[model samples]
Target: MATRCLRYGSLAFLVAQDTALVLLMRYSRSHATGEMYLASTAVCCMEVLKLCVCVGMLYAGEARGSISGLVNVFRREFLEKPSEVLRLAVPSFLYLLQNNLLYFALSNLRATPYKVTYNLKILTSALFSVTMLGQKLSKRKWLSLIALFVGVTVVQSDNHKSDSDAPHPETGLGYQTLGFLAVVAAAFTSGFCGVYQQKILQAGKTNMWVRNAQMGLTSVCLGVVSTIVKDRQAIQERGFFQGYTRLVWTVIIIQAVGGLNVAFILKYADNILKGFAAAFSTVASCVLEMAIMHFRPTATFLLGGALINVAAYCYNTPGRKDGNKLPR
Candidate 1:
C-alpha cells in the first residue's frame, strides 16, 4: 500500500511539475518586459539547482544514517572507475542539448504548438526503447503510438490555424522550418537520452541521487562551454541573471525541480510511464490555460486530448494471449 501510494504520489508530482514547466516557459517567453534569456544560461542555472539538490539529498541521507559511510561515495567511485561515471555523464549531455533546443523551439513557436510537436518524443522514445533497450512492443502498442501521433498532428494543425489568425502571424517559412527542425532534433535527443540513461541506471546499483549529481556536474560544464560559445557577447553586455524578474526566477525554480524529479522518475519508472505523464501534463496545460489565461479550447484540442488519453490507455493496458487485446 505504501509503495502504491508512493507511485501515485510521484506520478502526480510529475504531472504538476511538467504543467508548471510549460506555463513558466510560456510566461518567460511572452513577458512584456522584453526580457530575453540565453538558453545556455538557463540550462546552466537548472543544472546548478539540480546539483545542489543532489548534494543536499546525499547529506540528508547521511544524517539519517542510511548512507553513513558513503559520504564520499561519488568521489571514490569516480577515482576508482572514472570511466563508469563518464559512461553515464557523457550520454547525459544529450539532455542538455535537447533542453537548449527546446528553449529555442519554444521561443519560435507558441506554447500549444510546441507541446503538440513535442509529443512526438513519445514515439521517438518507444523506437529507442525497442532498438537500444532491446525491448519488444505488441501491435497494440504500435497502434497506440500511431493514434498518439495522429492526435498530436491534429492539435498542431489547429494551432497553426490559430497562429494564422493572429495579427502578427509568423509567415516566415525559414523561421517555421527552423523551429520544426529544432523540435524534431529535440525529440530525437530526448528519446536517445532517456533510453541511454535508463541503460545506465540498470547497469549498476548506483543511487539515483549520485547519478543526478554526476549528470548535473557534467551538464553544468557543458552549459558553461555552450554559453561561452553561443552567448558570450550577450552575457558580457547584460550579465548573467540580467532581466531576471520574480516570474523568471519562478521559471528557473520550476525548471530545476522538474529536472530533479525526472531523474527520480526515470530511476523508479520507465520511459513509457514518463511519456504518459507528459501527455497528461499537456492536456492539463490546455485546461489550465483555459481557466487562467482565458484561452478557449478548440474542438480539435478537445478531440486531440481525448484521443491522446485513449492512446495512453491502449499503450499501458496488457495484451491478451489470444490477440493484441487491452487488459480486462
Candidate 2:
C-alpha cells in the first residue's frame, strides 16, 4: 500500500509542480514589475536551495541526525566512491542546461506554444529510456504517446490561431523562432537527464537522499559558475538578489524544490510516467492560463484535451504490461 501510494503520490506531485512552477514563473517574469530578476541568478539560488535541502534530508535519513554518521556517509559516498559524484554530474549538468535553455525558450515563446513544443521531450525521453535503461514500451503505449503529442498540438493550434488573429497583451512572448529551437534543445536535454537520473536513483545501492545530495552539490557548483559568467555585469551593477520580490521568491522556491519532487518520482516511478505527468501539466496549465484571461477555449481545444484524456487511459489500462521486450 505504501509503495503504491508513493508511486501515485509522486506522480501527482509532478503534475502539480510542473503546472505551478511554470505559471509562477510566467507571473514573476512578465506581470510583476519592479526590476525583473535575472533568470541566471534564480537558477543559482535554486541550486543552492536544493543542495541545502538535500543535505538536510541526507543528514536526517542516512546519518540518523548524527554529525559523525553524516561524515561517515560522506566518506562512503563521496570519498571512497568519488566517482559517484561525477556520475551525478552528468544528469546535473544536463538538467542545468535544460533549465537555462528554458529561460531562453519561455522568453521567446508564449505560454501555450511553449508547453506544446516542450512535449517533444516526451519523445526524446522515450528514446533515451529504451537505449539507456532497457525499458520496454508496448505498441499500445506508443500509440498513447502519439495521441498525447497530437492532442496537445491540436489543443494549442486553436489558441495559436486565436493569438494571431488578436494579439492580446500576452506575457512571456518573445521571438518565436529562437524560442522554438531553445525549447527543442531543452526537450532533448530533459529526456537524457531524466532517464539517466532514473537509472541511478533506482539502483538501490545508495540512499535516494544521498544521491540527491551528490547531484545537488554538483548542480550548485555548476550553477554558480554559470551565473557568474552570464550575469557578471548585472550582478556588479545591481546585486545578486536585485529585482527580487515575494512572488519571485515563490517562483525560486517552487523551481528549486522541484529536484526533490522529481527525485521521489524517479525513485518510485520511471521516465515515461513522468512524461505523462508533464503532459498533463501542460494541458492543465494552458487551461488555467485561459481561465485567467477569461478566454473561452475553442472546440479544437476541447477535442484535443479529450484525446489526451483518452490517451492517458489507454496508456494505463489495467493488467497490461508497459511494452514488448525490445532487443537492446
Candidate 3:
C-alpha cells in the first residue's frame, strides 16, 4: 500500500513538474531571453546534473564491494563493451534534437496551442512501437489515434484563425509554420528514441541510471557543439548567459529536474503511463496559461482538448490482459 501511494505521489509530482517546465520555457522565451543557444546550454547543464546525480545514487546504493571494484566495473563496461552504451546513447543524442526543436516551437506558439499540438506524440509513439517493437495495435487503438489527430487538427486550425486576427499576422504565419514543422519533427524523433530506449533496456543488464548518465554525456557533448555552431553570432554580441534573469534560471533548473524525473519514469513506468502524464500535463498547462498569462481558451480549443483527452484515455487503457505486453 505504501509503495503504491509513493508511486502515485511520484506520478502526480511528475505531471506538475512537466507542466511547470513548459510554462517556464514559454516565459523564458517571451520575457528573459530568446536565444536558443543559451537555452541549449541550460539543457547541457541539465544533462551534467543528471549524470552527477545518477553517479551519486549508484555509488551510494547500487554499488557493491569497494570503491575500486565499482570503478573497475565501470571501466570494463564503458571501455570493454562500449557498444552497449552507444546503442542507447546514439538514439539519445538524436532525441536531443527533438528537445531543442521543442524549445523553438514553444517560443513561437502560445502555451495552450503548443500543448495541444504536442499531444500528437502519443500517436507517433504508438506507430513507432508497432513498427519497431513488433507490437500490434487493436482496431480501437487505431480509432483512438485517428481521433487524437483530428483533435489536434481542430485545435491547430483554431489557433491559426486566432493568429490571423492579430496584428502582424504575416509574421505569425512564418513563425507558426516553422514551429509546426519543428514540432512534427520532434514528435517523430521522440517516438523513435523512446522505442529505441525501451529496446535497449530490455536487451541488457545495464543499469538504468548508467544508461541515463551515458545519454546525458552524449547530449552534453552534442549540445555544446551545436550551441557553438548555432549561437556564435549571438554569443559574440551579447555573451553567453547575457539576459539571464531569475526566471530564466528557474526555467533551467526545472528543465533539469524534469529530465531526471523522466529518466526515473522511463525506468519504472510503462509507455502508457508516460503518455498519460504528457496528456495530463497538457491539461495542466492550459490551466496554468489561463491563470498566469490571462489567456482565454476558445470554445473550439476546449472541444478539441476534450476530444484529445478522451482519445488518449482510449488509446492507453488496456483492452485485454494480453495487451499489457505491448509496451515491453
Candidate 4:
C-alpha cells in the first residue's frame, strides 16, 4: 500500500510540476515589461542548483552526515573514476541544449502551442529507445508514434499564419519561426538524451544521486561555457542576475527541482503512467493557457491535442498481454 501511494504521489507531483513550469515560463517570457532575463544564465543556474542538490542527496544517503565520508565517496566516484563521469557528458550537454530550446520556444510561442509541439519528444525518444536500447515495440507503439508525428505536424500548422490572420499577442514579436525551429531541435535532443541516460542508469547499480551529480557537474561546466560564449557581452553590461525577479526565480526553482522529480518517477513508477501524467499536464496547460494567457485555441489545435493524447496512450501502454490501464 505504501509503495502504491508513493507511486501515485510522485506521478501526481510530476503532472502538476510540469504543467506549472510550462505556464509560468510562458507568462514570464511573453508578459514581461522590463529587461528580460537571459535564458542561458537561467539554465546555468539551474544546473548549479541541481548539482548542489544531488551532492547533498548523495551525502545524506552515502555519507551518513559525515563530511569526511562524503568527501571520500565523492572522490571515489567523481575524481577517482573519471571515466564514469565522462560517460555522462553527452547526455548532460544535450539536456542543457534542450532546456535552452524550451525557453526559446516558450518565449516566442504561447503556452498552448509550445506544450503541444513539445510532445514530439515522445516519438523521438521511442525511436532512440528502440535503436539504442534494443527495445521492441508492438504494432500499437509504431502506429502511435506515427500518429504522434502527424499530430505534432498538425500542431505546427497553427504556427504559420497568413497575412490575413493577425498575429497573436504572444507572438507579436515576430520570432515564431525561430521559436518553432528551436523546439523541433529540442525534441530531437530530448529523444536521444533520454535513451542515452536510461542506458547509463541501467548499466550499473551505482547510486542514482551520484550519477546525477556527475551529469550536473558536467552540465554546469558546459552551461558556464555556453553562457560566456553567447552572453559574455550581455553579462558584462548587465549582471548575471540582472532582470531577474521573483517570478524568474520561481521558474528556475521549478526547472531545477522538476528534473530531480522526474528521476524519482522513473525510479519508482512505470513509464506508461509517466506518459499519462505528461498527457494530463499537456491538457492542464491547454486549459491554463486559455484562462491565464487568453489563448484562443483553434479547431485544428484541439484536434491535434486529441490525437497527441491518444498517441501517448498507445505508445506508452504495453501490449495486450500486459494489462495496465490509465488511472481513473
Give the Å error, residue 327, model 2. Answer: 19
| CA lDDT of each prediction against the hidden true structure | 0.73, 0.76, 0.72, 0.80
lDDT per residue for candidate 1 within 33-101, as digits (tens), equals: 555666688788887888888878776774354454455665565567677768766666888888888
What TM-scores do the predictions have? 0.87, 0.87, 0.87, 0.91
- Badly placed stretches (over 4 Å) of model 4 are 1-6, 159-173, 269-276, 319-328
Candidates 1 and 4 compared: the better one by lDDT is 4
List the lowest-lDDT window of 10 residues for candidate 2.
162-171
Backbone clash pairs for candidate 1 read none
The top-ranked prediction according to lDDT is 4
Q: Give a tens-digit lDDT track for model 4, residues 112-209.
A: 77778878777777678779877777777788889988988888887433222333353354377777898889988977876777667756788879
Q: List ranges where model 1 is wrong by over 4 Å.
A: 62-71, 159-177, 322-328
Greater-TM-score candidate between 2 and 4:
4
C-alpha-based local distance difference test score of model 1: 0.73
Scored by TM-score, the top model is 4
lDDT preference between candidates 2 and 4, better one: 4
| Alpha carbon lDDT at 205, candidate 4 | 88
lDDT (C-alpha) at residue 31 in model 1: 46
**How much is 70 displaced in model 3, in angstroms?**
5.3
